[model samples]
Target chain A: MSGSDRTASLSYDRTGDVRMSSSRVVSLIARREILTRLKDKGFIASSIFIIVLIMGSVVFQVLIQSGASNVTVGLTGAPQGLSAAIQEQADIFGLDAEVIEYDDESAARAAVQGEEIDAAVIDGNSVLVSESLDDTLGAAINGAVNGLALARRLVDEGVDPTILQPVSLDVTALQPAADDAEEVGEKALVAFVSILLLYTLLIFFGQFIAQGVVEEKASRVIEVLLAAVRPWQLLAGKIIGLGVLALAQLVLICAAGLGGAIAFDILTVPGAAIATVVQVLGWFLLGFTLVAALFAVCGALVSRQEDLQSVLLPMTLILVAALVLAITAGQNPDGSLARVTSFVPVLSTMVMPIRVATGSVAWWEIALSVALMVLAIVVVVRIGGRIYAGALLGKGGRVKIKDALAAERVS
Target chain B: MLEFDGLRKSYGANVVLDEVSFTVAPGQMYGFCGSNGAGKTTTMRIAMGLARADAGEVRWQQRPIDLEVRRRIGYMPEERGLYPKMPVAEQLEYFARLHGMNSAAARCSATDLLDGMGLGKRSKDALEKLSLGNQQRVQLAAALVSNPDVLILDEPFSGLDPTGVDALAANLAERRSRGVPVLFSSHQLDLVERLCDAVGILAGGTIVASGTVAQLREREANRQLRVVIPGSDGHWARELGYAHVDSAQDGVVLLQLDDPSRDQDVLSAAMAAGSVAQFGWRQPTLVEMFREAVAA
Candidate 1:
């Protein structure tokens, strides 16, 4: 080859050739790992298990939507039109409302005396309506009945109907009500999917990175692997490959669930949250990485699969704590713990939901927390990689955490 | 070529290997025979870069061992390991990929090794479910599946049945024929005598003696001669008056007059019997040589 030709061949105009090479190697190693591990009965089975879990959640939501609520009510002497109106509104609101009709005021009053229904609307010489339910629904019935009665009396009194009924107060919520039935359903959906996404991603992928490292160590496969690649490379591969698997599962299951919801006109979540799914995904990646590395470091300290529980407790509790924080964050999101935990890497995975539950978090806070988590992941990868490399070659004895971190070059 | 230069290692104050050194050239099968706790495992591990030495270094091809060199060196620890839950074929192939073999190559090598070892039918079986001897074969196959250049095996024959031992010896010989240098440690002195081109005899955490089989035998300063005849009592030893190791009937005596200066006199005395069927001065087998070295 000529000199110019050699130079031309060497150059692809790929400015980041070294990075490209590194990533390519990482991708290949990770791909190999994923293929081998994914073929594992445990991995495949648990994946199927997760899919079932996700599908079960969908079924659960559907069942809950279709089932009758745990509330009972009775009505008496209500006008036919007003009762029909109340029942129609209740049905549309996904409430289980049962309206019972009574013969006379005394009879309706007697039923109320018997406590048969939660509420009664009685029409008589003086309008008597039972206040068993919310005032809004009760007031609705009252307004409808009282207006009709007043109009009737005006006619009876030979007065102009429009003149007697001069004033009315139209009570409305300070905030806007959703325009369409689908919007309300969509709002309900965002909360559920977000929670599901957070739960599945952390659990599925977190366990993966941990177990993959431990398998290599226990089987002596890591000895062979450590010969050819650095510990970080192996770990990064496991994390990236299995992490991708978990994320893919998430997208597939969530898409199927949401698609079915849309197809059946159940509930719809907003698309605005779709763009910010990256933020949630970002949080997951950071959290998964940190926990995965720490779990692996801990996993290396144990040899048997049975020992995983004790080794996994710290990470498990951290996860449980984070999840608990996240759930509590959903309720009264501005609470002190919720506020502090949301920004902390240890607690961020749990805290994102609370922020979403309440309102949009400050963009700066998202950036800062994500940045902090990413930085933590980098440090973890570095230290965890060292620990893994050092301990992988050792025999069945558990390597202490400190000894693994102190890098004395192996002969 | 793999070389260890002035390697020193110790477990606490108790020295395991003191300034140990050896060179394994291509196509050479260097067997390391040692008494228990002789530091053969430690030296081999340091050469494989698996263990850190207190002093000295391991060099491959006149330089420090690198990743590329490591890729070419197959290692089998005396303490064996395999993924218990992984299928046999997949387990071997997965380790092959770690050595830079593509998936297809790994699969092909794994299948071929399993088939050759009479385990083709059980390729998909879990490792833990296999018989211990079969697991040993699988471990051997994992080492060879990558077709490594320098092989380091610790006690490869220790736990093997007769057939498994034969399989391993055959495998190592084949690798030698293919010009892959091999370093292996074992207490099976007889097998090492038969299979190794050169042997390193480790005792008391150091190489007390190392040479070709003939050289090691020659290094012994005495001869042990066994003579048998059809007639004459154990007192035919009166006919052959020399230091005797053991004596047996009609006329049989293991003359162990270990003074090499008197080798001819002893041989001539045994040959004096006109009815002597066989008499020759013989250096001890490696098993005897090892016993003597350890005794020393």
Candidate 2:
């Protein structure tokens, strides 16, 4: 088929040219709401003021990192000349190691017991010992003590100390997988960022849709506009318009806040996290459209703003439950509950990113979650749009959900 | 021009409009007069495309009124709506934008309309902060801000003082002069009688009496016009074959003219008699006509 012919076949005729609808009404709606919201003192001032707070928090976290735990080593015997080298290793490991002079081995043991030092290192002829049951600590000390003992043996065997030490073994990790420390740090950073973005977006855009609906209903302005636009179209406009607004704010914060950290090397995220960012963004859009649409519908059902929280409280509880499940997913991305909710529309927006960050899930699961979310958004738009249209015109009375449904069914 | 064709709507079992049909022509001021539950509100809502009718359609010209048609139609609902917290200018601009004006144009037109309404500087004031009269004035401005081609206002003059009433009367007349069709519903029968070229009286979801005010007045054959003059009024009445002289006040004798057209002879005779003064026509008011319609 020709390109035009294929498109013609693909696109069905809706009451009017649905194609032309985007720029025609959508632009007007977006421009009106965005301009008014941008002029709002809350949006403008908080956007500026919040970033300063976040930047301050970042600085405080970095400062706290500087005062890491300092430990002391009580060494019983330092096989001649190894003391200085062992001290270098301790400093490299980001710990403070002080060699304490002990008159007897019992005194060194007492020092470790009395908490005067972190550990007591007693040098036997070939073995090394620490007081606690920590074998790794004993091993680490032994490695340092043995290197010094080897140097002493070489000198005693008539080899020059400098010549014997000519060959040096610089310890290196054998496998890249052993670098779980950096990986864990990277995963923790991703988790924090994802959760922050998810919660902020939900709150920001949810309020936008909810409050916009309340405004329209309150002024009874909706009665006039319902004459022109279809119910769904109006609801869709507010959701999409404010969705664009919240997205713009997110991009701004992400650019300045996360962007600065990534660029400065204070934070590092995985390549998968990058891909997950894009996926998470899609889910963000989907989840928000669904949530915001539902809130708009709820807002219309109520006559006043005071009743908003009562309706919203239940929805908030659902979100909290989903977030809890999302955290559970982050810790174990492949667990049954995590895997299932990760692909579920409501929970996936918060869960899927962490899953992608920590676990190797099948690519199809990501696609399925997105597909399900898209479906959820469509359903919300249809159902919520109908309810909004029906409920919007009912003034001075509660908008009965049953009545709205009945009206839709009858029409 | 907006036209409702056999429009029918009901709430539960109560029919608000049953096959109601009417045409509001361009540049003519039409009044909708009805008692409570007389389907006046429902008809106007249907005409404005705000409510759905079970059976017929509301058409602009021949086709059903679409969004484009709706945009060109201004409606002031009965409840006196203005965003209580929104500033006057912002509220007006929002409605204007919904009617297809861009933000800048909407703001400009809204500002100009507010200034013309004598609410210029108060445009920044919240709607609730304004006095009730001024708030109503802003509501009127909201309806007019879009410069709609057809205006449908429900009870647009109910709570207004004389000045407010005059403003509505003059504004509607101005719009009519500019070739806009204006139809409004009101219980103030006197105002409706004075302002409308055509009046439709509805009762029980149907138009009971409709046509020009003159036609409705002419339909009330039982009502008679009384003409009066001073001195020789009794003799003049006898000459004109009048049944009786009703009364006299301020040297003006009341003569019951069975025919409203037989006034010229009385006028000439009164001049011949002495000092003829009270010469005018009084059509029966809509309150009387409404009572007649409701009875039917």
Candidate 3:
């Protein structure tokens, strides 16, 4: 370490002609965030878990639907064409019914009593059952028997059944037709799933952004990062990077759920389910951006992880409230409360997805909700970016938001 | 050239920097010396654009520094930091890329810098896994990864061992020779004196004195002289009416001369009092100069 040796300096050879563009700086920062989280075992494991849960639910629904749809019935001394008549009636009612013929009434009664068949129609006149007949199977058998007796009477009276015009009441309601029970059940399920995914992903990704912001401050690395780029750029990079990751995960889970349901024939209307998935993804981006900006600001307000919860409480509460409202909206998607809340910014991201899944939201309502969410995102990011820039370098404890706003811009 | 032009900053009613201005020319190393809370870190932060100056701007090559230009300056903050969980080489490469190096160039630069710092073997280890000294070296390497055009380091030499200090000094000297302006603050005044071509002594939120080491010495009044008169008892110089005795030890007396032109008169007076054993002008060291400046 002599003076002469100190004079023998190492040469720093400059290496490239590349100059960093602002977008490139943002992308570089984003790339770092993405890589860091991608390596996180928790993030990876949670994503896989969500997808598996969705696929598992779809499989469970398939098993239940198939078991509930099949029915078996026994027949004894059935008249000519009676078996075909029952089959036709079951087919018209969308039932998967199997009609088994016994050698006599005694055998048919014995089969029903033994529970080998769900019920029995003896001599094409009376229906016997083990305990009580399945309503759908009983209706099919009654329709077949009544239709056969009417045809026989008409022939014996020498009346031409075709000429005596078949009559059925042409029913109409003054109001729009209500969704049948099954359809309503399907819509409710769709709403529940989409809203739950939106709520969960929103909160999960929001905390990630918050933790990320605090990590840099806690480690005191924000100062070095702020030196080369503007604070807004750093914040933007974080939001966009984590936002992309969350979006990818949401898409993966949605695809898994939809694919499983369609493959197992659980979802009869694939088109509607696919549309709900798209809407949820779209709402997710908007909602995530809105919350992420605030989370970043809140995170910058604190220098330690222990202090993060208090700072994050307000935003977390907002998310919880959104989740509750979304659940409520799922139950009453056509109610005015749901209708109006579906247009609110943060609430809309949760509620509107449910409304859309129920097919109760108009195109303009969705468009308005999305537009408002985007607007909210812009405003939040603007103010939040400032606070983030202003507070990121503060040391110790928590930085007051007012002071942070008044502080000098990092750039 | 990098210039901090009349920068002023205050926190509430507490003024941190007051009209602070200094410049580091191309190929010049400017040492920033200040006591604790003397605004050294603030000035450097302002230069790096990590903090904004209330009244002035930092300029390079006669233009004000903006975000784009700031990317060209390598900065090390007072608080030593990098992503602790990130591997050494990856962290360095990330910093290099942030400063505008392309991917391949960043990777190459990171490798070379790590090898130079003797951290080549631990490049794949997380930063926290390295010993404190090695972490300090990696911090330095992060600042130099992009081969920045200007280096603004706060307390860059505070924790380095002698060998580490020498390596960093040599590295900075090379950058200076290559026409990069370096402004680094340190508590080690002797090192600043040895390494910087020019130095700025900051006190009470302002640069009270700044120039080459020799220029600062020349600007200081009252030169000290060490005179030895074997039997004089050390009172002769004070009795001569043109000097003050700063200290007296054994037979040698340290005298502060009121005027430089009277050195010969003091010499003749010492000779008349007794046999002169030694007489020489004692140049004030940077430590001494620093104390005097801060005290003033």
Candidate 4:
């Protein structure tokens, strides 16, 4: 016999009993789950891919927005004073307009037709545009041109243009909405990204927990696992472990995106951006727990991987529906449908975050939504744990969900 | 000691186990044998707490088994289960941890058990990479890794080769000698006869016969005599009015004596017919005892 053989034989003689702690066992199981998943190449590759995608998208959005802000126009037979007036008007309207002096009317018209300039002003009178102008751009250009024409008319009438100019009136409004239009735009972007991240993370990690449960069942390792820990402990440990992994990946992606945006000057306030990330994360935990518990139950309903699709279809459809509702809510944040769904459990995970971003949802509504989600999670975990304990030991083909629910717990 | 007390279970209207009961004393090896769907697996499963019994309980040392006590018992289900993707050593160690062994102890125990099973060299290999028999050995190693106080193995020898059987039997004997009560179900009566101190034969969801090998064989002794007469036709024993002729072949006749005290009458009859070479009472084998129990 080898040394190990001798040791093995001696083990039977050695009768020291080790104490078992339920929490310790749960932690160990959780550690095993985390370690195994972290080592999976598929998980690592997907996480890195999502991070890169988020960062790349932020950079692309910044480039497009910056490009859209600047407008180039051609001028022909225009007064030097008119050029300065256009510059001043453009600055007031927050437009970056560059004037290119053309030698004659044909040059300015050709420039507008060739797309070199957005529009053209020929002889400080008629504006030339190949296509119809946007409202904001037209208003700014028409105002500038009309102001210069008025000044020229005043000079011809033997009155000084400066004396004819009306006294500027500066009226300050007392109250403003919490955020400006630009801030609201930024919030909408943040909310959209957050919702997308939540949807992706919930679906991916929910399936992950389900797959893990099915793997243990298929391999028959669940038998041994249940002997040591209660079914609820196992389920809780799996959800927590996978939830942590999903959160880590989510944080990485969000940080990369927001960091990229900040670096490119697209997002001005880091504090607000971080707050949004935190809020999304908080909702993610609630949504993930509810969905993941249900997933574990779904997984226990089948023993084979091939049968997983049938068992998991309803939950998948629910997730997809939630995502669709959230996206529609994103479109009209203050709509009645968005307001109603924001208080629902699964839909709220997606809707409330967007409402928090785009609309001024009252604090009480946020509280009610979170409370409802917690209630749903509690109910789901209770039912899911029971099903998991009952159906985990069943063998043969897929177990009927009704039968699993009716079956008695072994422990 | 491990006691299964009147475990009754049913799935819907189908009763899988009906008032099944047995006991395995300390240091005793109990062999559980049954026909297909005779509730052998169900009984073991209930004992291991993998399935709930409609009534009855599994007691360890006169106390009902709970999670704390269950952790000290080793169980191998009829359906062999091991994570195919996990390395053999890690899988065993994980099971040890589930059984309440600390990480370092689990590692050591897994290493030792694998080495004892002659799978030390293949410990690093994924379970799927090993041959079927080696995988079975690893499953057995997993059961032994916890150094359990009680063992409930459901068909541990179903798919093993001769060497695998011997190794498992030896390890089980070692555990038994160390005062651990071992209960395992198997169809191999020969191995069971050689290894088990007591045997329980189940039929129709109940134990039909259960006792030591000799005790069961003694219970089955019906005072049948095997008579070998040289140069005599097989019909002579039938002509002597022995109503139950168990078998007759090649001048040898096995007869169940209607009156055991009248054995001399049949013996004299055989002597008058021809020279009697051998005449003696027959001892039943375990296989014969099992068949009789099942048949009854």
Q: Name the candidate, 1 or 4, with the larger TM-score value.
A: 4
Superposed model 4: Cα runs more than 4 Å off? A1-4, A7-9, A13-18, A70-88, A96-176, B239-243
Task: Sort by TM-score, best first.
Answer: 3, 4, 1, 2
Isolated chain B TM-score per model:
0.84, 0.80, 0.96, 0.95
- Say which candidate scores most in TM-score: 3
* Model 1, runs deviating above 4 Å: A1-29, A36-45, A54-146, A152-193, A260-269, A273-278, A394-398, A406-411, B221-281
Each prediction's fraction of true contacts recovered: 0.25, 0.22, 0.55, 0.47
**Worst window of 10 by summed lDDT in candidate 3 chain A:** A1-10
> Which residue pairs collide in model 2, if any?
none
C-alpha DockQ of every model: 0.17, 0.26, 0.45, 0.45
User: Which of candidates 2 and 4 is the stronger one according to TM-score?
Assistant: 4
DockQ of prediction 3: 0.45
lDDT of 1 by residue, A102-138 (tens): 7766776677667665566655223333454565445
Put the candidates in DockQ order, highest first. 4, 3, 2, 1
Query: What lDDT tens digits, residue by residue, belong to model 4 across residues B137-165?
Result: 88888788888889989899989988778
iRMSD (Å), candidate 2: 15.6
Off by over 4 Å in 2: A1-22, A43-66, A69-88, A91-181, A263-265, A268-276, A408-411, B102-105, B222-282
lDDT per residue as tens, model 3, B1-296 = 78889999999899999999988899899999999999998898888877779899889999999878888888889998889888999999999999888888889878887877777889999999999988988888888888888898999998889988988888887778789999989898989999998999999999999999989988764478889877677877768787888887778999887787898998999998889999888878999999999999
Indicate whether candidate 2 or candidate 3 has the larger TM-score.
Answer: 3
| Residue A228 Cα positional deviation in candidate 4, in Å, after optimal superposition | 2.9
Q: What is the TM-score of each predicted model, taking all chains together? A: 0.78, 0.77, 0.89, 0.88
Q: Candidate 2, residue A352: CA error in Å?
A: 1.0
